[model samples]
Target: MSVTPEAAARLRAYLAYFRDLGVHEFYRWSEPAAQALEPAAAVEAPAPSIAAATGVLPPATPPVVAPPLEIDDRELQPAHMLPPSLREPPAPALRSFDDLVPLPATTIPAADRPAALKVIQDEIGDCTRCPLAYGGRRKIVFADGDPNTELMFIGEGPGADEDAQGLPFVGKAGQLLNNMINAMGLKREQVYIANIVKCRPPANRTPEYVEASTCSQFLIKQIDVVQPKVIVALGSTAATYLLGRKQALAGLRGSFHSARGAKVAVTYHPAFLLREPRMKGEAWKDLQMVMRELGLKPPVKQ
Candidate 1:
């Protein structure tokens, strides 16, 4: 019988496997051996059997199932995942409210030296604690004189001159104030001068009720700190701020009022003297009253 090319190749492979199993040659023992192998030889040979008594059987292999390929869906998205270079920086750590140190209270202690002045200064700088803060320049003109002085001159709010210089009594009215101080035989430094409201009203108008109320605390604290034997409230606003009433200046003047437990006397504002220069006589009289109350010498006649 003739063998096809495929059968010849199968026979070669089977022969090679038999050689590896130490079977160099084969001989047919009987007709049954030839008949039994003939069908297998026509097809691919079975793998060698471990036992020679048993016929060779092909090795059974399990079917291999490959894993499905992963396709990234990001390419189809409108927004792409940021590359390492394009990634955002980490946000800064937030500070905890608990971690913040609380600021010390700014309340002025009664009769404390520079501490009281410091409180006044700090309050004056940004004193919105009152409505007056809205209508004036950035700063409130707190008094600038001896904080320890026994005499204090309390005035109304700042005028054009006082506001510009950040000092009390620096205009024509301030000139008059200096004359009045000198006439009473006292230097400006010997007396401490302040205003009811540290800031000036618009167009030198009288301070409003709300503004005066706001600045009242500062004036009271000032009185406590100065511990002055006598206080001269320079105008109606000053009188109102100290006394909490808007009485006529004439009635309020020439009388004693209590301010932070100190003796207070109301008098015309220096600016009022500018408007009514004749009032200087009355102002001088008020200054004499102040001197007499404080045991100071009376003004010498010119």
Candidate 2:
């Protein structure tokens, strides 16, 4: 019988799943297959070869898996053949997960968070800390959402909708962000939101380095108060300031960097996403990493 393409895909998918589970050796497949593609690549492009999809080659070192319990497959199963408990799968051996994720957010008492955040806002009142303050903006867009959240999003600066509303992330890009958060099984209010510069930069250009640097202290203070477990730096400007240096978005993305005692994941800004929708998948992958740390499950596919 001819192997259907669908069957081939399912088989390869199973292989990849097993490979990650530490099952590298499959009699019918080899390691060359899994080497054809990388998980991070899968986010950027179409799926690769089946061999790559299904990791067939076992690791050079035996993976840390459940103890190898020998089981006889000589005959059909029967209750009389083996105890029910014996048929159970073994627990996986412990593996070093030390660097896999950041420590979970230290829980801040809800009652104290508001008062603490208020202190920062009060200090920022009628701010003219930088040239950004003269950018024809009527109000300062400080932030939005909960101060007690374990997740926070820091964007480059406010846009028209945000500046007019005196709130961060209330524009078309904000809508996209809302969808992104919903995909991660979270709400706009569940996570705190802020910006590198409280005032909108002229014509929505990148916040100038000096403006970003001047206002970053307040942003840093806000982060210190919230102490979110993870902070998503939207776009390169946000990343540069949060990470304390200039870096290509590509270079800065795809991993967690420690910033202000929190884990940070850098990705394209929502405004950029609106312009280049194809990159949304890549952005989604970044968010998934944050979700994993927060133990959040994505919304079910329709």
Candidate 3:
């Protein structure tokens, strides 16, 4: 019959989060007609109605009586209150990159890789295959750097700079990535660069599951063509999609994993290292492991 002001505010915030995730429908949880509340408590402290509380229209069906719940407005837990359809679903088991499809019996020739990649890009032309296409992305930030390089770097997705330039790793993070590349005794032009998702997510937030899964097909093709000796996954998202498994960056890092015939190494993203400078040393260790695998020596100082 009534919701407290504090409870109403919490509900509004929770509903806003769900709405951003594209969950627009909701059902109001109310008591049955048989268990009417006393008039005195209802009148003494009237608050917002259920529909007003969540900013959603009440269901057309008559309110069905559910068992009474004693919820604390201070620490609102609305998921249980929402219907099963509206509740956040459990994370599904992600299919690994190798599992997506069998590797081609033969690799594309180095001379034809650029053309082959172009074909994949052409296939993805003016793509609306995912929600990111309509999310104000200026351009699809596709793969960059040498197509025949022995090494590759895959990041989460484009940011403002990459979105604007239509190239991956072209921002402050990109600058730092260039520095990392130089430190690895390689020029930026000598290795490939790409992302798990080609488009910049709104507000640069991590791409949602649908967005990432939808965009992964192109990335898988890119990796298959490049056939890099080693791939440096620039963050957990990159690692997750490339390896086709969801695990902590800590567990995924410090070891080599294989995907599409490339040895994968997980590390912190340049953007993350910029935020937590202390982690630079740890990231360097991960890179060193890659350098060892690639037989690469750090560039000597002048």
Candidate 4:
């Protein structure tokens, strides 16, 4: 049967959902054999006394026939799109950043990194690669700051302010981030910044696994081109995707992780700091670890 465009779109969504759940393969079940008319059909029939008692069996009764079952293709197509909750096995595992894609064969020379990053951006133009494209994202907030910088910051995803401006970190959280950057004795333009997903999730919600995984390819490429000496993962979401594991932020912080040929440090997102200002000290500690690696020191007060 031919699938209409609308139906095909829905099918794609269902498939994406299942793919995120880690169900890559599906198999068709064969139809069950028709049932017998008599309950004793399997019984060794009392020596077939009644029917075979005589060659003259009473006109030989015919076997009952069952009608074919009608199924709706619309409802049954992609029948394996069941929720993971209903399945016996756990959902598919999340892949870490390194597993998402390999680094480019060769590093981009410092002089060419800008143009190299632009190429990746152009490839993602008007992207509809994931559900986020349709989730009311006004603009795609690509990476900001120096392409050749040795330090990069990765956030969860775009927020409303960033989505509207097509630039990362312009809102209140961004302001806090700017302060954090300054505290590290660096200018905003001296460091690169990006997010797990470019497009903003609906209502600024965290990105879903499918959305993050789909959008992160470009991010991986961005990381490769920039080839930062260190990447600071801001928040649990960023850490989850970068390190490719699910762990509490408390544990992930205060230590160095690795991703895409660079050292990774986990910290509280600026947004999180806004909600819990007390944690700013802890976040600063994480940044200090990054600073020490880069040999950076806070600026002297006037």
Candidate 5:
């Protein structure tokens, strides 16, 4: 049953009117209608939400972390951990006898005696024990001769001749000493000659105790260095210093005394003999004693 051409046209017009009123498809033109409707459907869908408009929440925040506590490796003990005795103060340091008082300028050991003599010589340059150190153009009156000689001659101090020449016993007294040494059949070089004090005393006044004390260590060091077999203490000062006595020279002389483990013979100083020439014989007798102690024969008179 085909419809007439006019009926077909009338049916097509009804279908198109139905599509315009929101009918999705009319069977006769459904394929073309679907193609046209697709574009409008795609355009009507709401756009995907924008990230900023949606108010997206941030990823969960990590929790706050506390700092690690530091630990000391050492073990802590209580105050009572140490023994009571350990808490007490340390004992005081021990001191020697010499520490109680100041020692002398020259306190050299016996082994170092020679070195000490050199030190003293270097220190006391042109020294005048009293006023002689400054009196004139004086070089230091250093003691000379063998430091280890067996016989030692001790005088009071340097004199005018000794001060000028820088050698001991250089004046008239020195000539007498030379003659005395010759009388013993020995040269001055064979023995050692020194003074109680190295420098000369002013106006040849006797040395005071302070002066003697100041120079005593040097003399002692010399004796210790020489270890002499016989020591001749020439004058009162020498005798007194060596013997530690203030006895009269008349009594102290003509006798031998043990001085620092050596035989010390006392005699009148050559200067004294110069003043009192009458005592020359006595001085000669004293020299005999010195020679006798040393086991040397007296010289024969020519």
Candidate 6:
């Protein structure tokens, strides 16, 4: 059976991420696995790290000898596409809202989410399904982060650098976000970052009503894939859509709201704070709520 094109696209995005992490060299796969799943031709670099500029990792896992990464081509194919003799048995049905959180109650067994998320990304392939597709944009910026992370950040859409690089953030605004995450005693890779729409709107404008509505389904799927303990809506665009209504950021900014079964907090965009640096303090207040929720320590003053 052929691996669904949808699944293969994600494999590319996923591998591209590993490539960015500088850890791709630690492993290798057999030629068939490489040929079957190589997304090298499709995706460029993994979505840039808009959360943390550089990772703060635990001591590296001691290297151990292992068998060559040789996966069966049959395993790559989705069950629906496989022949009767090759098709594997279907797994048990997930309980209602099971997809919202991990099995056994929002914990371990992230349910192979990386692969599932890759499938979702593929489903959105070369997305001409909307008017936003036709733009000076080079590539669609899907998302960035560990698929199984516990904290997430969602913003409006791709900006100039983001569009050019095919990654979210990665501009002056992204640098500010990096500082925010660092202040919370967290690393960028510890949380997930995504935007409402994958494509960049013309002239960096806000995504249209139809655009946001259409791209939102993918965002919901992304949220479910991450199962975060809390999500910080990075601006009014993020807040308005995540909560599903038009409202001022003032009314929505100070407290926790619910969306896709995750605790949502609204805050100003980094780009806004750049123009109004005084507001960084206010943004910090919102981020502090995120820290408390995650039981993170405040950065001690030097």
> Which candidate achieves the best TM-score against the true structure?
3
Candidate 4 residue spans exceeding 4 A from truth: 1-89
Report clashes for each candidate as comma-separated counts: 0, 4, 1, 1, 2, 1
lDDT of 5 by residue, 1-302 (tens): 22334544555565565566556553544665445333322346566557546888467676433333343222234435655654545533332112323334443454675686787776665455554456453544567666656788888888877878888888888888888888887878877888877666777778766666667666665666666788888888888777776778899777788765578888889989889999989888888998888788757777
User: Model 2: residues >4 Å from true position, as ranges?
Assistant: 1-108
**Candidate 1 ranges with C-alpha deviation above 4 Å:** 1-112, 136-138, 298-302
Residues 106-187, candidate 4: write the lDDT tens digits: 8778999889999999999999999999988899988899999999999999899999999999999999999999999999
RMSD of each: 31.6, 24.3, 12.3, 12.9, 41.2, 28.0
Off by over 4 Å in 3: 1-89
On the 0 to 100 scale, the lDDT of residue 213 in model 3 is 93
The alpha-carbon deviation from the true structure for residue 259 of candidate 1, after best TM-score superposition, in angstroms, is 1.8
Please, what is the TM-score per model? 0.59, 0.63, 0.73, 0.72, 0.58, 0.64
Predictions in order: lDDT:
0.70, 0.78, 0.86, 0.86, 0.69, 0.80
- Misplaced by over 4 Å in model 5 are 1-116, 125-137, 300-302
TM-score of 5: 0.58
Candidate 1's residue-wise lDDT over 50-156, tens digit each? 86347655676764433334544443444336565545565333221112222233533435677768876886666667666667564568887777777788887
List model 6 lDDT by residue over 43-114, tens digit each: 466664644457754575753333334434565587887788887666333222223334334533586888
Residue 13 in candidate 6, Cα distance off native in Å = 61
lDDT of the structure predicted as candidate 5: 0.69
Off by over 4 Å in 6: 1-108
Q: Which ten residues in a row have the lowest lDDT in candidate 3?
A: 33-42
Candidate 4 TM-score, true structure as reference: 0.72
Clashes of 2: 4
